[model samples]
Target: MALSKVFVSLMLLISLISTVSSTGVIGGKALPPKKPPVAVAPAYAPIYSPAPSPIAVPPTPAASPPVYAPVRRLIAVQGVVYGKPCSDWGHDTLMHASPLPGAEVRLVCHGKPKENPLKIMATTDKNGYFFILATKKVSEYGAQKRCRVFLQSAPTNSKFIHSTHMNGGLSGAYLRYTKPAKPLLFALYTVGPFAYEPLPSVCHQKV
Candidate 1:
């Protein structure tokens, strides 16, 4: 009797297990088989187009600086030359000294009553005027100022440095004087002892 009971119990347990599985009780439903994961294609990097280079804007040019010229000292001289009347000088009575074309003239400054005066020379215009005539023509000069001057005719070799015992009736000083030579010289000279040395010295050098 016990052997039969044991067999019967075994069969009953097997039947219960099968029924539980098929009925889906206690989470016994058959599970779908898991497929292997699909192979993933590697994502390609986006094609590299070099990033557009930024357009460079050029900077504006700097403004140019202003330029200036040096100031020139301007002097004015006016006078009559005696025989220096140019070819155009019409009459003997016309302001004969107005201007003499082609006459070369000079002006001078003396370091003192003794030393040779500093000389500045110029040729006359058609009007017989010299801008560089003499420094005393400037408003800022005086009589008894130690100076001597002479004029030379170019292309003619005619020089007319003048000789004077009394100029402008002043006693000691020599002044701007005129000698009447168209191509001849208009110059200044002294009767004093100092005159000889410089006259010949200058005459030899330039005249």
Candidate 2:
């Protein structure tokens, strides 16, 4: 009617530019442009701290005191030898005590007087006894602080005479300290009845 109302307003402006170039959200349902709110950096949920438990120390008790070892001692000695027939046959300490069989005892000491004395021989058994095991390396029983018992020999058909006062004479017969000696010896001595005295029949001056 005026060219059909200007051709119906130019065909309604080309149908609204072909619905905004074929649906890039011109009319309603295409909602994708509010990008500025994306700064939501607060949701960082990584807080996990739970791992630490182990502390136990208790054990110390042995307070010092228990160490022992020391007990070693040794020594041994023994004796017997007697005879008495002539102080007139009776100085009677039991009427002339016999038993001097095969006698030959010696164990004298007093060392270093030029080193040749400390005898140590033994012989008198048949009832006369006489044992000797004393030793601290060659026995004078402890090698010399004291030692004696010397009747060196007596039995040439019995004429005997070593009664240096018969043992109570006391200048000897010492060294007597027994008990304790077994693979362990330092000193141990035992002396005797040790006596001898028969000699009063000498009549021969024939020239």
- Clash counts per candidate, in order, are 15, 2
Best by TM-score: 1
Q: Write the per-residue lDDT of candidate 2 for residues 1-207, one digit (tens) a residue.
A: 899999999999899778866775676767465567556567787998888676676768778898776433333345666776554343535255778777777766665668776566778787877776644445433443545777677755765554545553235666655555464444556665766666544312211
TM-score of each: 0.28, 0.26
lDDT by residue for model 1 (1-207), tens: 999999999999999888876764645565565599999999998898899999999998999888886432223333323332232122223332333355544455556557665566556555444454344333223422544434444313333232222222113334543333453222322211111011344445543
- lDDT value, residue 59 of candidate 1: 92
Alpha-carbon local distance difference test for all models: 0.42, 0.61
Clashes (candidate 1): 15
